[model samples]
Target chain A: MATESGTSTRFRSQTADFDAETGLAVDAALAGLDALDIPTTQRRPLASRAWAATWPKIGALALFLLLWQLVVWSGWKPSYVLPGPGKALSEFGSRLGTSHFWDALARTLVRAVEGYALAVVIGVVVGVAVSRSTILRTAVGSFITALQTMPSIVWFPLAILLFKLSESAIMFVVVLGAAPSVANGVIYGVDYVPPLLVRVGRSMGASGFSLYRYVVAPAALPSVLAGLKQGWAFAWRSLMAGELLVIVPGHPSVGADLQNSRELLDTVGVMASMITIFVVGVVVDAAFNTADQRMRVRRGLVAEGTSAVRAARGSRGLGVAGGAVDPVGSSGDGTMPPPADPGAGGGDGGHSGGAG
Target chain B: MTAVRSDTAVRIDGVSRFFGSGAARVQALDNVSLDVRSGEFLCLLGASGCGKSTLLGLITGLDAPTTGTVDTTNRRAGMMFQDSALLPWLTAGGNIEVPLRLRGIRRGERRERVERLLAMVRLAGLADKRPHELSGGMRQRVSLARAFAQEADILCMDEPFGALDAMTRDLLHDELERIWRETGVTVIFVTHDVREAVRLGDRIVLLSSRPGRVAEVFDVDIERPRRIDSARVAELATVVTTRLREEVGRHGH
Candidate 1:
């Protein structure tokens, strides 16, 4: 590895003979990465993101379990009222093979998925529509915000009355709760899209539906995905609330099962149910977070070494000095290192070359 | 008055743009008339709030002049901005091929055009790289390629290289000269940088700030690929700077 002085010396030598034009060019070449270094404050990777990626959310679970145990041991609440981890695990084991528990879990999962999928489709479509139109944006934007502000649980009663206590009734409440957040996410994403990007799209002859398909949608994806995540939270909460209030004879949703387990003074069963809900939420959230990070990485938003290296390469092409890097070594891809020197300045910068 | 109509690629006749009405009204441009020539590099040099960009917008049909007619027979006009306004989602090649894609060019033709444009801008291997993947200069190069891909006869650039460092800007000036020579396209470049104006333009047109009006027009008899350090370029830059300073001083700033 080059010493620190060697690196600085190399940079100085590279640009030593540069004219005003070349000096500006070299600076411009490196200008893109002016703010790329991760801030010291953000140097520590967030566990939330890491937990969302790896299947080992077990660490957090262990901490949570310890906290629960502490709460019980410390007599924060009556042991009988707030069951300990051991009681909850025992309760979970007892219900593992039971048909009621399996059916409740399946039913809740299916309804949540249904509500979530529906919300994503409608939310993205309506969101794009509202965001694109001035009148619609002004008129419906506030309404969507208001809907998000209202708790999904509040819609449970109205939805039951409207759909008359069917599966669709519960779904209606879930959809109402989740769709608004998703729509808002998409709307906000589109709203935040840089005006310059939109202008670029227009110059490229993108207009009408093509404009959104090509520019607006992709640009708004991060926000749309965020909305989807939020939508799921809303959907999950709404489904549980709907199931708790609207009773079905054969089908007991997780929420209803929790209530019934409580009615029978089975605190362990209630704890088990709560744990299941928490686990599912965690899993779904992890999935969304993973997908979002992957997308950002693909878009080069992450401050990974690969990007830093490429940035260094760009400077090299402009005849700026870079610290000596292995010309052909193993890259992150586990293959031969990417082309180290594409012969940028020799000529034919006007022709097809892989250097840039 | 009305000298050699054929020399003009753009005709902004008696153009006046006003915002709001009555007491709250502001006249952005008043009775502005100009003729931008065919295949000539013209710089619209002005200060902030001078409506130089507005004039360019009127020429490009992005916005209409409230009280005048901008008539240009050319059906297509290309525009560049200071921000480099590239589509972050699209790869450099994909962004370059956008105009072709919109025009219903076949996939093969689109690829060919994109490749050619990328080559022209010296950004060949960046086909798959998104805007964020490239450095600022590279992004601007991609933007330049995109503008060229429009195949417009006239190119209107509003401080296209403003955000770039001096070295990159100068390098691009050389690249732009090469491109202009290769393709005989008319250019209307707007910039606040007088040295840039002197270096890049065949004709420099100055606009006074606030309710912008044409102040003076100077023909830059400088040769191609004009060196920034060259005596001629420096002399012209100095003269233009003095004129600009005097104009600004009239506003008591």
Candidate 2:
């Protein structure tokens, strides 16, 4: 009994030592990750990281404004044609205080949102149909590609002819412009889902709709997100064009504002409206970028955290290869030492590391 | 080890499988017949393109035989592939929960079963980890747990450990053998490795390529906990390897 108790005490101490060793190794590995600008499990506060990301964008905008001011100062074009940056800025500031400007912005945004939602529904249905059936894919696949490449402006005339310069005309053109790209994205995503995953799903008794839901959809998500981003670009551009062409009597949109500014020879208003459109595009694109980045980081497809940390690590010449640090923490877990054969463990380690 | 029961877990009779048609047609399996006894660890040993995996497909109902029959008594068969095939989106525990969810097991039961399976595979505390975050061996272990979670009477493994390093493979052999012994589930393991077959298989059936057919069947009388490098396993492997080589030689012409 005494010997057994002594043995138990010894085992407890050994376990304690092993746990301490593992803790040290984990700390060291996390430090190495920090040195490489790779985030460990617990990252820094989100707000600071977001601020770190935002500053560069702000800098780029400032540089863009400086460039615009220099171009205006060069006197290449008359002030009537290309307004000075200060003139546009003052127009923008004044516009921000006006209720009419906000209403116009809101109207344009609502139309774009409605059109985008419709495009998503149409694109997903058509894409899934074409992807599932060889006949549909063969017959309509090229047609869809052709449609995507076709100038969206071509659809505007038909849309206006059908709806007679109404909001419906604008929405019709927006849907037409975006749906093809979204469908193509879904098709490509479904086509490229790893065959092995499908087989695995099948082995688990997943069939038909369940198979698509549990396996196909999730696997195709990254590509689908890519397509959605592309589709949004098309939708946004088409909406702007539509608003410019099809002016409803009471609805004052950014696109309508551009046309009015052009007609009235308010060059500063036109430039300000153009800047607003450009900023809107950038802002929407940034939203999509953030969503895509989050998905990529979650999948471990890309590294997370601030580029400033990456640059700092780069300057230090640490050159620690990504995905090399053992996450299992087995190196220091003495009690659960890796498989008896070092060669075997080493080979698998190399393989998984390279794959990651 | 339990006595090899007379009751069969899987039976394949006069099975022939052909892929494509006319000019492009290629026969994958021809007149292959076999019976896997209940609670037996049977290895389907063959060369590349020997239809070992095709035979597994037939048993698992992933593919139907063009001629003849593969009867698993309509019982669902679990399968593990060469790759881990764990869903990237799901965590290790979530992957295991897939089959349980499919089988319509209650949420409470699924959670309990997933934990048990994870512990069985020695991957406890790794439930929340993504497949990419884990080692290859760990991922494979998760895959194994996923297969076992199906609770099928028969488990078909298609060279599941072929991509694993030797040490990991050896460790897994021990784990699989222990699991098989403990659960008493019938296992039909397909592999090209003769030592692995000898190490794990209670019965080894050799197949020849070019319209794969059963070339030989050897009853492995080795005791439980057989080591891959054991002299007894080596002795049996030599005899099986010689027959396997002869089968491969026949295809050389």
Candidate 3:
């Protein structure tokens, strides 16, 4: 009996220790948070995080440019075959100043956006349709996987035959390449969603559309976003491939420019065209990366340093609310133990605790 | 077989659940009969594949017993699981409001009730916080709050706190005891934890593996807010552990 009381007393003091450690951690975190500048209503971390995220990519770009300049100066290949960073930049600027270059760039940009947007819309719709139904998921899922595995360039010949080598034909190829990726993404996202989450939704009486909206869709967002990123890569690559193969008269898309440069053996223009495509791909990838990081940060999955602080704040809030009824001194009934582990008493700590 | 009293909230009579057919056929639950009293905290203790969870699933209307009737008078029943199961996308308050919303509670009233329950779980300020924002213990608390908010007469938990660490599980025990006392709701909790069964249950029912059937049932005379190291809890825990060990031992033999 005396030992039991001693254990309770020790437990109470341990609770106090936890609260104190939490409080100290929170104070330090709040101090660190002073640097974070997270807005009260803001879903995302402060501007500093965004700035930090961009800096590395910017540094990498600078490094790449430096390396390219070095390679050019070293005569790694002939000057025309491999232009220096300075020459490329000058050529890019010269192209930028011309109406012809602008027209070509504009046409390519429009096509890329059109194809990408079409893929996203069709992909998401078809993906969701396929994922939600077992029959569709089973029947078309294999086909979608097959399409995704096959190279986009393979579809260029088929696309030319289908649309008679027109701009619309190129868009069709891009859609074919990207839609499978998007659909597959949605399928995988829905598949991977934590079963606990689905059960929770059911317990809450959410089923059918309400359940999907409230639980499934949001839970699958990160994976769906990943699929969207993959889809974008496919769309961009397919568009470039289609453009190179299908030479349209009186129009100057990047793919067409590449073909023209190659025909004339203007290796500089071919390299320039390739560089433009690479830069665009890099920029799009960076944008998606930023979005993914922001989502994770908002969910508190990343940035573990702030966890104790947030938890401490929650405890403080609890303490303040309970104070009116129980008062501060009586709050030591040891009922609240500063957010300790709920599954601790189970023999093993490795039980399935949360959602997928 | 002991005759079940009429005051039973749950009565499983002559239930036999079989999986597969022919040579592969397996009887998950064979000729099981049990009575769970109204407002009683009954823990269904069993090993993996002992059909404890399958039994709970049948009771919750998620599955059907192949050869028996599960009668609960159509009372609103809520089920919790080993996982907190709180939606990562939903805030604690939002999760709690789900059952209420489903029952067609007015938006204002749902919000008010969710607010009250959040405070009850001591998660008042964290109403706007998502599940991912919560710690493991906090998430389970939110889950418990959500389960209670369902306003069900019978709450079925499948090792609800099984994933938590020792300290948080103990604290939740206190919290659950407080809630159970205040609500007087009937609870059918399932777990493999011997001590947890002793700590929370009014009656502990141990089921044997391979064609699961009731091995033993012990009535715990422990009072509310029972401490982990309480003599009564330890004593009952010892009795149940011994019975469970013997049951498991018989299988190995």
Candidate 4:
């Protein structure tokens, strides 16, 4: 027991006994240690990285198109009914140039923007408010989660009843579909923020709304962004459903055209419109994923910004925020400790490197 | 408020902190009291579950004692946690600038102050590096810089170097001591390492665990620039450790 005490308190730096040479040597060692801090990884060029990310997606598109063409030539269905990829591509191309198609596209795009904007405003306001109040959270937290899972199609009947067969009806459903996800995003984001970061902020003299703004809000951003992505998905689906159900006269919308093509049995037109929907879905989803990915990379939560880099690393998906992820990614600012592992912990690729 | 208390940076009077309520109530500190003199380096030393951190929280105003008072008067406190607690999203310079920005310091001034703090911590050129980009020691250095950015009179550190390797911890000890001496900022450093406490502290306050109470306080008469390996430091550390073990022994069945 006495020996254990002696060992525990053992000290090594005896500068009192150190002569001038030893001190200079120690200074060199210290300087060497300082210089040996891990080197920051170089960023790949933007054009190359962009190309790298684009290729696999392009390759997948080619593979999908080839299979679709093969299926048509295989006589699985008549050409008129199913249409070949080539035929559909040409039809979509032709539609792109036509005023009629552009008008329908504009109508669809306009509705999507308006509905989503409304949903975001409502969702963020409600989500932040509900998260802050214990009583409100207890009252409506679970309810929001329930709404997120509910098929937005379920809301169309009620929306129609409230707003009639107009743009408002479509917008009502879109906002309903999107808001819960956004609100839930903010709530969960706020709830999951690490208590340690909050304590640091408080000690730094952050209080009241500024604390919320600088610390809590920024810390909660990752989850909130996730929520917004989910919310957009819901809003898009609702708008599509609304466009089909509440077809207003004089409005040549994407959904209305889809309905018209099916009724007229203009199979090529139907395929083209279906292509439009699929393309829009892919594009919007890509937009959200890109935003999320860039944000994560910027915060250093993930290894690299480009999807190609992530794919190469065999990472399952964009990393979540925490010790496992990175605060350097999309969270509150602080001198947060990296995880235990050197390779995994530091903002980008950290190492507990250097001993001199 | 009185003239006699003018030199005291912090005065804790009969502070007893309890968690929970009723039968489940757990007392973390039992009538713990100490005075942190202005511009002095004080170490709160004890084993795990000793309420060393609880006491720190009280002094920092992050938590309050259930009984008694902790009076820091008008002086603000800046703290360093075990984890760097650096916002992962910001660069090292950005992290140091947090407190300054919180006080609504303008952007130009914030940048200039962050640069100075970074240089003070021996991290001059790496301000733009994010927390993850730097090593553990580097991150901790940034954390230290951020704490100092608050420009508070009292600095509270909760095992700031506990997770670091021996060499890094030793180096940081030198850095912290140099900074303390240069700035004359009163420090209330918490640590479990006996040698570490002896190496850095002006006086060591040892608390016994399980309803922590002050078992003893030792004045470290060792001269400035005392290394952890010094004979005098080792001697004091050994004496303190023996008493700490005795306190820990009381808990054993």
**Cα RMSD (angstroms) for every candidate in the order listed:** 14.0, 11.2, 12.9, 9.1
TM-score of chain B of each: 0.94, 0.96, 0.94, 0.97
Least accurate 10 contiguous residues by lDDT in model 3 chain A: A320-329
Q: Put the candidates in TM-score order, highest first.
A: 4, 2, 1, 3
Candidate achieving higher DockQ, 1 or 2: 1
Candidate 1 structure quality by residue, lDDT tens digits, A286-352: 5765675465555554433223454446431221122122222211111111221211111112221
Give the number of the best model, judged by TM-score.
Answer: 4
Residue by residue across B137-245, what tens digits does model 1's lDDT show? 6677788888888887678898988987776687688667656655667789999998899998989998887788888899999865578789999999999999998
Q: Model 1 Cα displacement at A121 (Å)? A: 4.0
> What does candidate 3's lDDT look like per residue over A229-277, in tens digits?
7777777777888888887888788889888998998877777777787
TM-score for each model: 0.79, 0.84, 0.77, 0.88
Q: In model 3, how large is the Cα lDDT of residue A67?
A: 86
lDDT of 2 at A11: 37
Off by over 4 Å in 2: A1-52, A305-356, B1-6
Q: Is 2 or 4 the stronger prediction by lDDT?
A: 4
Q: In model 2 chain B, which range of ten residues has the least summed lDDT?
A: B1-10
Fnat values, candidates in order: 0.23, 0.23, 0.19, 0.35
Error of 3 at A93 (Å): 2.4
Model 2, A201-312: lDDT tens per residue?
9999999988998899988776677668777877887888888788999999999999999899999998889889988977786677677556545555534552223433
DockQ, candidate 1, comes to 0.18
lDDT of 4: 0.77
lDDT of 4 by residue, A1-356 (tens): 01111111222233334324344554565566666765455566778667666776777889999999889989989888989888888999988989998899999999999988989999899988898899998898788877766777777788888888999988888888788877877777887777988898898888889789768887787777777776776777788888888899999999899889889999998889989988897787667666766666656655564333344556643322222233332222332233222112211221111100
Query: Model 3: runs farther than 4 Å from truth?
Result: A1-55, A76-81, A97-102, A125-139, A261-268, A304-356, B1-7, B101-106
